[model samples]
Target: MRVLGVDPGLTRCGVGVVEGVAGRPLTMVGVGVVRTPADAELGHRLVEIERGIERWLDEYRPERLAVERVFSQHNVRTVMGTAQASAVAMLCAARRGIPVALHTPSEVKAAVTGSGRADKAQVGAMVTRLLRLDAPPKPADAADALALAICHIWRAPAQNRLQQAVAAHRTLKGRTA
Candidate 1:
């Protein structure tokens, strides 16, 4: 499966693409950050984010989009920007009919580093090793985006099975009723 992972932020939204299935080697198709001027108007920044995400979707044509879910933070302003950027990413993927998955920060960290409380350095180190890169992706955010993709790739199989099981159970229950 090909996945485009998005680490959304107001100024620097990270983007990375990874391709592979579970229990096998994965390839990093691409990695980069979408930058919008901090001074830009809120609407303008969102537009810039939309354009950047759209370009990535057009180029990568990923089967799934994995985005970092926005969580409540003490800094309301920062959280607001992140939520806005995240919405833009989801919008772009929805426009292309690409499936979107939202993973929490702790969930991503645990998947990549075996610890939900892992620090940035630990996550980056694990991402570097997982993708077989000589060096960690820069700016932390970039590495985070890659980590999100890796997490999704590894977890998707089990998630699919669980969904299928639930569907089957619902069908069986309906028949009995």
Candidate 2:
């Protein structure tokens, strides 16, 4: 499966495309950061983000989109920008009928580095190793985006099975009721 991972930020949103399934070698299809001027109006920034995400979706045509889940931070403004950027990513994918998954920062770290507390350096190093790239992706955001894709690629199979089981159980219970 090809997955596009998005590390959303107002100023520098990371976008990456990876292809592979669980237990198979993965390939990096594309990776880049989307930059918007901090001084840009919020509405204009969001539009720029939307356009960037749409371009990636059109080019890579990923089957799924995995985005970093926005969590609480001390800075409300930062969090709000992140959430808005994330929303644009989700909207872009949804419009294209691609499945979207949100993975927490810790989940992505654990998936890539075997530790939830892994630092940015560790995550970047692991991502470079996993993708078999000679050098790590730059600016941290780029590597984080790749890590998010890797996390989804590894976890989606089990997640799908769990969802199916829950749906079947609900159907059975409803019929009995």
Which one wins on lDDT? 2
lDDT of 1 at 87: 97
Residue 160 lDDT, candidate 2, scale 0-100 = 98
For candidate 2, lDDT tens digit of each residue in 74-113?
9999999999999999999998899999999999999999
- Residue lDDT tens for model 1, 27-138: 9999999999998899999999999999999899999999999998899999999999999999999988999998999999999999999999999999999999999999
Model 1 clashing residue pairs (backbone): none
lDDT of each: 0.95, 0.96
How many angstroms is residue 122 displaced in model 1 relative to the true structure, after the best TM-score fit?
Answer: 0.7
After aligning candidate 2 to the native by TM-score, how far in Å is the CA of 127 from where it should be? 0.3
Runs in model 1 lying further than 4 Å from the true structure: 173-177
